[model samples]
Target chain A: MSAVAAALPLADDALVLSHRLAEWLGHAPELEEELALANISLDLLGQARACYALLGDEDALAYRREEREFRNLQLVEQPNGDFAHTITRQLFFSVWQELLFGRVTGTGPPAAVAAKAVKETAYHRDHAEQWTLRLGDGTEESHRRTQRAVDALWRYTGELFQPLEGLDIAMEPLRRDWRARIGDILARATLTMPEGPDADAWSAGAGRQGVHTESFGRMLAEMQHLHRSHPGAVW
Target chain B: MISLAELGVLRDVRLLDGGRTAEVELTPTYTGCPALEAMAEDIRRALHTADPRLARVSVRTVLSPPWSTDDITEEGRRKLAAAGIAPPRRPGPARGPVPVALAIRCPRCGSTDTELISRFSSTACKALRRCRTCREPFDHVKEV
Candidate 1:
């Protein structure tokens, strides 16, 4: 794939996930959590903006793209089901992003962006892991809910191991490292690992090819609504 | 003149054609910061006022060596603290997989008994912290 093609999917992943995290503003469990989530969202949005700027106008690329044109991973497009679900999603994605960016730093097309982003992704992954441990080991109710989230999101994790065309990093080691790290976290959290599909099993995801979950359409519509309504409007 | 240099955004400035034209390079503290455009406009205005015969004033943004809190000058730190916004702690080791929380001294009381209330604040570059000694909530410049 071309450099633009490679960047578009990664950019879309950040943009879509950022919007989902932004939805937690005013709805998070507490003020601190709200701030934290919003900050994470903003960080992701920043990454998206940087990536999109490499192609064309960041706003137009983000706000004007149709659902069919978006190339985000299905994991990001998944709805933020609850606090546990959100944390789970973040933990999974951040781990992959931190590892991916780490591998691509100084070598890939987006190396400059990755160099900065890996640092941010490290913090993001740490935040999610901390929360995962807290919720998974805290109480009976919390553990149960967190376990359910883990199980529900397990299928989407496979896509992270899939290869992107232009990024030259090896996927096998990344997948191995991701599993080992996630397993260690799960063990520490006292959370039961979900019986994920076999490594060789056919994984279900195509967002890199512009295919997305049903919920993505609704989310994209809402995200683009304001921009579409007021063309060339500025605050 | 609005001091973009003191704001830690201006990376470099040059005068060409015997000071007739001005060229400035800027780096934003955060990628999505809304102030970059305003900062560029201010630079142009300031350059024009400095030399009415200036042939041209050009502003460029560079991101190669990303901006960090360490870029804030000592004077800038004083200005920020005076304005009730805490200056960032000297950056620690580079970020790694395990995120370590650094001990930030309280800007108000100069006490080391500050705790992070949140990892993020209203702005992208600040974190919410509170000083236990003074029992006051404040914002700390986040180490990016």
Candidate 2:
């Protein structure tokens, strides 16, 4: 894979996550959660935009491309299952993101973009952990649901760490370090990791190769509809 | 309007506009536009482009009374629209111009019948709203 192959997926992950979080904007159970989710979504969108900007600023390159152009991990494109599912995804992804960002921020990538994303992901990780703990222990139903969500999403977690073509070589060691850090946090939280076929280790190749689950098609249909329909539509 | 003289940004004791450099008070587009740096840079550029001689100009970033939809002026709305921006959701009821409630009109669909789906949009400065009629998501302009 080329830099674009590696980069689009990174940007797609953030952008998709941003879209899902955007869904929970006013609809969150509470004002604080509402604000928090919105904030998280905003951060992710910012990260995605930065990633997109770096990859290709051309509207066509970013939004007008076909479904295969997106290279985000399946975990990100996964539908926002129930709230539990969504939170589960967040818990798992944020842990990884936080960890990756923590290490990357130390010294890797461009100082401006990477540093900014690193700071934002730190908050995302914190926010996700706090919610996981809350939902994991708050009530019987919430706890059970979140735990189940953990179990379901666990299968996809491995993909987050599997090295891919064109991945930032300098960031490889940090990515490994991130896995360990994420592992420690999950253990302390007493959260159960999911089990299933490795979403990231697809024999056909993972999302990094632009091979995605069915959900990506639908996501692209909706996301790309307007831009495709009215070429160059802005504002 | 607080006097720049109080902030010591004024060059002379004169109270007239020309007596001092143009005051540039910066407000985030919504709540947390993250594009603040870009916006700030834009303002500086706009100022410089307008008049390079305007030195000692003061640009203040005030977060107080955090931006609300209410702050959107008629002129701002037009500029936002012309810029292809979905203007801020009108303050008041979430639905279409409640006439009494003052909700924003949707850019995706001109329908005033809109409901705020989220108080936060992709950016803090904008809130997410859905047009009841179009079911399309739109950005509500924040007061800032």
Candidate 3:
């Protein structure tokens, strides 16, 4: 795939996830959690903007794209289930992103962006890790809920390790590092790893090829509603 | 009108063609910052006000050598502190394999006994921190 093609998937991943996090604005558990989630969402949105700007008008690309045209991973598009579910999703995605961006930092067109973004991803990963550990080891109910989230989201983790077309970074090392890091965090959090078939046959994914989960369309419609309704409306 | 330089986004300014035109370079603190366009427009307006004979004004956003908290000037830091926002600590060496805990002083009380409540705050570049001595919650600029 071309550079733009490769970048699109990465961009879409951030865009979709950013929206999902933004959904938590007023609904987070506490005031601090509310701001934290918004900040993370903004960071992801920034990354998406930087990548989209590489192609053309960032606003047009974000608002005008069809559902099938988006190349985000299915993991990011999955509905935010609960606090534990969101944290699980954040942990999985941020760990992969930290590792992926770490490799891409000094490489090519994305090097500068990756260099700046990796630091943010590191903080994101740390935030998720801290929460995972706290909730997992906190109470019996908290531990059970956190574990349930871990198992439910495990299936989606494999798609993150899959190789993108135009990116030259080695996937094997990233996968290895991701597994090692996540395994350690899970162990510390007193959470068990989900056991099942690998990402290829068992897990449901295919977003990189423009295929998405059923919920993605609904989320996209909501996200694009205002932009589509007003056409050229500006604040 | 707040100048881009005071906002800590302006990087460089140059007068070209024997002062007939002006060029300004700016870097956004965060990639998604909405103020970028407004800042550029502000620069253009300021230049026009300074010299009516100026034929052209160019504003560019530079991304390489990315913007960091370190770029915030001393004056800007004072302004931020006065506004009840803690300025970022001086950026140190590149992060190592192991995470290091850096002390964040309370902007209100100047106490080193501050605890990080969250790595993120209301904005992309700040963290939520609390001072143990003053018992006050404040915003600390994240060292980026």
Which model scores highest in lDDT? Answer: 3
| DockQ of every predicted complex | 0.54, 0.07, 0.66
DockQ of 2: 0.07
lDDT of 1 by residue, A1-235 (tens): 6544567878899999999999998899998889889888888888898888888998899999899899888899889998999999999899999999888745444777777777678778988999999999999999988999988888888778778867777899999999889988988999977776723244344787787778999999999999999977786
- Per-residue error at A71 for model 3, in Å? 0.7
Which regions of candidate 3 fall more than 4 Å away from where they truly are?
A: A105-108, A198-205, B1-8, B92-100
Assign candidate 1 its CAPRI class.
medium
Tens digits of lDDT, candidate 3, A1-235: 5555567888899999999999998899999899889988988998898888777888788999999899898889989999999999999999999989877744455666677788788889989999999999899998999999888877777778778877777888888898889889999999987777436473345788777778999999999999999887897
Model 1 global lDDT (CA atoms, 0 to 1): 0.83
- What residue runs in model 2 are displaced by over 4 Å at the alpha carbon? A1-6, A105-111, A164-190, A195-203, B1-144
| Distance from true location, Cα of A19 in model 1, Å | 0.8
- How displaced is residue A199 in candidate 1, in Å? 9.2
Chain A TM per prediction: 0.94, 0.83, 0.95
Taking all chains together, each candidate's TM-score versus the true structure is 0.89, 0.61, 0.91
* CAPRI class of candidate 3: medium
The recovered share of true contacts, given per candidate in order, is 0.46, 0.09, 0.62
Q: Which candidate gets the maximum TM-score versus the true structure?
A: 3
